[model samples]
Target: CATGSAAVRQGIRAIDANAARIVLVVGAEQMTTTSGPEIGKNLLKASYLPEEGDTPAGFAGVFGQIAQAYFQRYGDQSDALAMIAAKNHRNGVDNPYAQMRKDFGYEFCRHESEKNPFVAGPLKRTDCSLVSDGAAALVLADTATALKMRRAVAFRANEHVQDFLPMSKRDILAFEGCEQAWNQALNKAGVTLDDLSFVETHDCFTIAELIEYEAMGLAKPGEGAKLALDGETAKDGRLPVNPSGGLKAKGHPIGATGVSMHVLSAMQLVGEAGGIQVPGAKLGGIFNMGGAAVANYVSILDRIR
Candidate 1:
């Protein structure tokens, strides 16, 4: 189901094992043709059907429950979630390939009207990523071969950690698997969170991004909201995040999201990102997960050429 990042991970493994000189990883999904109810039913299968099969709104409803839990533990973060939504939407305007290119201001995102009604739990329509149809591919080669290319982005480290599928087993809000994956990747790369120039994280829902700030060590648990409210994740902030507009604005085509993130990060490193470029970016981080952080993957990339 989350084969995008898994494909890249396996491709790199194959190269490391001398099984291949170059590998092409492609992720594609065509979902718009299906009926809304059918899409929801299909996506719901990714979750543990025994426990979450009846979740309202499918994946959105699952994340909505996570949002409610987060609000209860850390106090209401509705305003912060709205800020994230607005920020990503604003960033999307510059992305030529993004699904929604309009900048929805903070006020509009914060207050829901008929145009943006509540979807699941506390999440409004704007808070959830759009259902999209897309495809993205990237080529991975060994260091020696990549050096011969005109431009190359090397993978400093790539780590994947899977957690219990049933949300009933773990503290759903902690995203422990995500934290572990990030820590492992950064350690293997010999870098800290501060060393990253930018990040392209999975923002399937605004609440997910808010919690991810904490999981990725940008803030202490229950304090992630402050990062958004204080502009710490803005394009010009201390550590810019989601310069690609994230799934929140870029559109989440399920299978395509992970490879798309790597493609965009590679673009940023090579100065090909156009308006969404992070100035003087050297190292970029990517986080892509599936089924409420069950399949957590983190990659730290550096420009080698």
Candidate 2:
């Protein structure tokens, strides 16, 4: 932590001093079976070089721990994440662009069958995100250049925020960085939560989507869980969320997630989305996080073109 922090601090200072216009930060993680294990080995190598056996478990194998702490602290009901999965699956069933198009119910996920296995304590094979190899890009243009491009999708607002590295260091119930990013995006979009007809967030796990309601200010602090239970986040709900099937069902392509979020949201606005289209979506939100909420990016997009 000390070493990495020092480098980041130095980088930020240099950029600020040089009058850099913008910074497009992305986390492109494409760890295959061999790569996943290798990353685990690398984390262990970096931290416990002298004592290899004492290193932390595989980094890819840690979402469950975060989910466990999340549900424990946030107070979830009936693994509400299942509803999020359902939403994504149903959406994917129609998304020709989606990685997973088959629809699976919560019943099967709750009761582990031949396929689904428990990854972390409470997170199941079906509950976790998929290791998809994909890419997403963001064209961060200055206000004038972005407006002049005319051929490009303008990133009206690209806000970045951060949280504690370790889950124990911050509140697991809600994403503080998400809230900050949300505020910045909405402000840049010149709208409020109500103005957005739909949203796309990093549903790496169902729990992340639940907290997004609060972070995005779509739901009250702890009441965001009800959005899932009440069908409010459904495709035709009052405020639909993750209409693109999300990382859980659509597949989590780390490098491409942020850009994908914008692309999916843009589809909704333009009415090009095959089956996951929202009725009259004009404004949308795309929220992406890296490394268990370590870094956050919130983008607000509209159909001005």
Candidate 3:
């Protein structure tokens, strides 16, 4: 997940030190080949819950619990979560590489039906990212060499932040590590959230996007729901988030997730995103996380050529 971006950032730094002229980074995953129950069991390994425990829902279950806790602390925001899901699904319609490009409208996403069932507590099937198989790659070169290249996207700032792995060790609602990574990247890049043209954020679950809105300084804690309800993260909104449909619609192939974010963000910045391009996009931001926001990575990128 977050390792894809972190590794690319390190490669870029190594190139700057003259370790190499060109660096190629690739990430891929194949999760759909496995059986559903086995996949669920394997993903549960990432959770702090003991493997032998009575809990059986896997990561979806863990995130659903987080959603429940958030609901308890703030207020029921099922509508807001639904809005995020619908928005991303709609956005995926324009993304050619998206795994689930079909447009599932708000009504379909908001309410549970025979087609859209509950996966775990509070979280519906629409709220979860799909099991997918995908890969993405990037070629990074020195500034001088990149100048001669056909296209150039420079990393303005890339930051990584780590938090406690155990869910019990920290506040599940805060996503403090995500906030810290965004702050550090923005500061290092000498820009604010408003400076970016668009963003491709990790939306492993719709609730994650809701929490990320607050973590990225778009809204105060407990107010992120308002952003989605008001359509702020919509494609035509003030600042489009996850214009590539995010992990929810675009697909979450584990290792490929972060790389996919970078690839799509770069496409937007260079006007190569085709139907999904954010008009006149010049700068793009990407946020990818591993585990439950334990490993966080943020990269601010700008078109240079």
Candidate with the greatest TM-score versus the true structure: 1
Which candidate would rank higher by lDDT, 1 or 2? 1
Per-residue lDDT over 10-32 for candidate 1, one digit per residue giving the tens place of the 0 to 100 score: 99999999999999999999999
Question: Model 2, residue 195: what's the lDDT?
Answer: 83
lDDT of 2 by residue, 104-137 (tens): 8767656666787766656667776776766544
Query: Residue 136 of model 1: what lDDT?
Result: 96
Compare candidates 2 and 3 on TM-score and give the better one.
Answer: 3
Clashing pairs in 3: none
Ranking by lDDT: 1, 3, 2
lDDT of 2 at 184: 85
lDDT (Cα, 0-100) at 28 in candidate 2? 47
The pairs that clash in candidate 1 are none
Task: Provide the RMSD of all predictions against the true structure, rounded to 1 decimal.
Answer: 0.8, 5.3, 1.4
Candidates ranked by TM-score: 1, 3, 2
- Write the number of the candidate with greater lDDT, choosing between 1 and 3: 1
Global lDDT of each model?
0.93, 0.67, 0.90
